[model samples]
Target: MTKSAEIETIAADWLRRREEPEWSSADQVALDQWLKLSTAHQAAYWRLEHGWRIADRIGALGPEISRPFSLAASLQTRWKRSRTAAVAAVVFALVAGSALWFHQRSDDVVATASFVTPVGGRGSIPLADGSRIELNTDTRLHTSVSKSERKVWLDQGEAYFDVAHRADEPFVVYAGTQTITVLGTKFSVRRDGDMVQVAVLEGRVRIDKDEGIERPRPAIVSRGDIALSRGEATLVTAHALGRVEDGLAWRDGRLVFDRMTIADAAAEFNRYSRIHIVIVDPVVADIRIGGSFQASNVDAFVRLLEDAYGLDVRREDSSIIISAG
Candidate 1:
């Protein structure tokens, strides 16, 4: 097995042990030490843990079979058979009756190009293969293109991709712990810390965790589909195509929030500027905010918050603080 496969196997074993009643401090210590040994180790553990949580969700959906032969229990059983094999089986069984789409291995990749956009900066690049990529503010990414495959690693921030069509060579994107594969499509991938969100604008894409385990049933995301994966779980939510287009307004230097929380809106606004927005009160943070604003215009947003919400705004050295009236 490859080194990645070995690490995934170890991670799966650790996850299995975690479910046992006899799990103890020593096991936890060992797992922690192992995870600290390498970023790859941590990633493997996160992927397996994510699959476990997905199994729990599947169980909750069907409480009848969940009683004795729960999806979670079945996954634990099959996991011991073989690390890579179990993932495919578990996902296939969980999403029964759905079409199975397996992950395809691509040729080896060597990072040949790198790009970064400064904070509050946006840029676009055309690749050798005719694909175009739009970098959002504060983004970093690397690309590797071979005759057989096209691959990009998103280190941070967000990017919108208009991929060139090549049936013989699939385009793959690696962001955090998620792997997104597509033939030819328009999609956006955002990586914020451990959270990864993928939105498809055109064509179809398959998304799964890149744990070195073969996933035969990845989430098939087509147009208007949004998939989010964080920590130990993943959720796929859908939106109208028009709404999806509106969400990408950031590419055009605007942020359009529709009744989003003030806290969340502040976080979004902060991504495009050095001046941060801080909510001084939890109640104020939860206030609903809506409308469109320029990405770089924090002052305008703050003014609206003060005037419309009847809140107090305080300007500090580096942050605009909002509080309850």
Candidate 2:
């Protein structure tokens, strides 16, 4: 193997050893020397370091080991002690910046540029960057992975991303006209008709207008917050962390509704199924319903609407029309 390839390989090995609680002092010293040999060595080591951090968050390397090792009992104690100096030198190469990266790249060359999931269809896509995207029905997304950034544009529907961290590059997802930017964070974004909603399951995300402005951005969504943009402004509602996942859990064929009006509730149900719901009675349409329902059974949901509120249902083509009894 070439020198750079050998360095990358050794760095990967050091990461494996670091994850284990039992690391001999000799191994530590060798790792220190490997890290200091050249700039490429340091860069490779830091790449492994960031991988460890992101892996820990996703529980990739197994359980956390808080056990401490003492340098006083080893042959390479002096070498391991000197390795602390390399930390500062490696920061630039290892750390991912917060700036957003955008590019006008085509998604061609791979099968097709984009694909749409029909109603009741769900599938997982493995991106070139090792990140995985779970796409829900009636969804369309265009993906382009580049050396500087990873971006996916969601034209419509919902998708959950378990993003892989790339320290040298930033990952950006464009849903509707808004851009959701992150270095490495787990989140879901959905575009419903004219509305766009973003829920962060882990880490953090930046939501901003398509056209950049020099002014301070409106909001940075962290865990437990739902950012919904209608037209002019984005509304952030603090919700239970569990509900945030449940809201995006439609990828698992589950639908969750919490104190939502019939009109809003019907809209959600319509997205996943072929049978759409139309509310004819304004009064009944405004009534709030709260509960969890399976997305597969549209007939059962129609039955629930009839059972809960005394409403008459009319089936027309592909939609169910509801009116006051």
Candidate 3:
């Protein structure tokens, strides 16, 4: 690496350590001395330090990206895995999320989300390749299109993708610890605190973890299947195709509830809306919720709760309180 590159990389490592909140006073003193060694060192250090801080801020607010289509979609029309320039392009597309977010904003808001698609504000983007992306509310994706491959890094929340086939490039979406690759596929990706849920509505896709420590075990999912990945990239479980379709029903603005808990249903609702739902009684949380409700109509859901089970819905400061009558 060049001298500047070396300095920047070193500073980045140290900054990462500093973020741990466990750095000793001696470590802090050492960092101060390193910063004072020369003007070049200080400048480079500040640049990287600022970069790390911005990344942390954005991470705290959730991923500052809109989940785009899978990389596999753009690379090949037929979805035959070719580990060539396509992988490089996919990696580049992965970074495109952060790149678009950075380039579009003034340096002042470099790490902050200037605007977020609020809950219930559904938007769609049509790519040059005829792929369509339906972004849910509170979803943030840095939008940019390029020749190599279409890429969008899903920073947070959920988005449904219907990718247009591109033989030379793959349409890929990266979220948290998981990466979803697809070609001419329809799917929904939900990125929660530490888990990523992927359901394929059409076509075949590969779900892999973002780890090189050990090559990930691949989970090949066809249409009508769901894959849940937790902890690491290791597959936890793959459910039946019908179950996958039920969980991914939100793409069509409908939610399919099959013996799910009220608490779990509320959690799912929270994903598409900013409004919070709190089940005051733990017992109420366990109550079975079935049938479909308009994903955006939380009020109707509240009314449904009242009518179906004689429960009460009271609004309290941005939170819907659910209590038994």
TM-scores for every predicted model: 0.64, 0.62, 0.61
Cα RMSD (Å) per model? 18.5, 16.2, 17.9
lDDT of all predictions, in order shown? 0.72, 0.65, 0.63
Candidate 2: regions farther than 4 A off: 1-112, 211-215, 230-232
In the range 119-194, model 3's lDDT, one tens digit per residue, is 6555444343567676665676643334444556777777788888778677777777777788778888877666
Candidate 3: list runs displaced more than 4 Å.
Answer: 1-116, 143-145, 236-239
The prediction achieving the highest TM-score against the true structure is 1
Q: Please give the ranking of all candidate structures by TM-score, highest first, separated by commas.
A: 1, 2, 3
- TM-score for candidate 2, please give it: 0.62
Candidate 2 per-residue lDDT over residues 125-193, each given as its tens digit: 544344667778778776654334466789988888888777867778887668888888888998987
Q: Cα miss at 14, model 1 (Å)?
A: 61
- The collision pairs in model 2 are none
Candidate 3, residue 20: the lDDT equals: 59
TM-score of 3: 0.61
Residue 115, model 3: Cα distance from true site in angstroms: 8.9
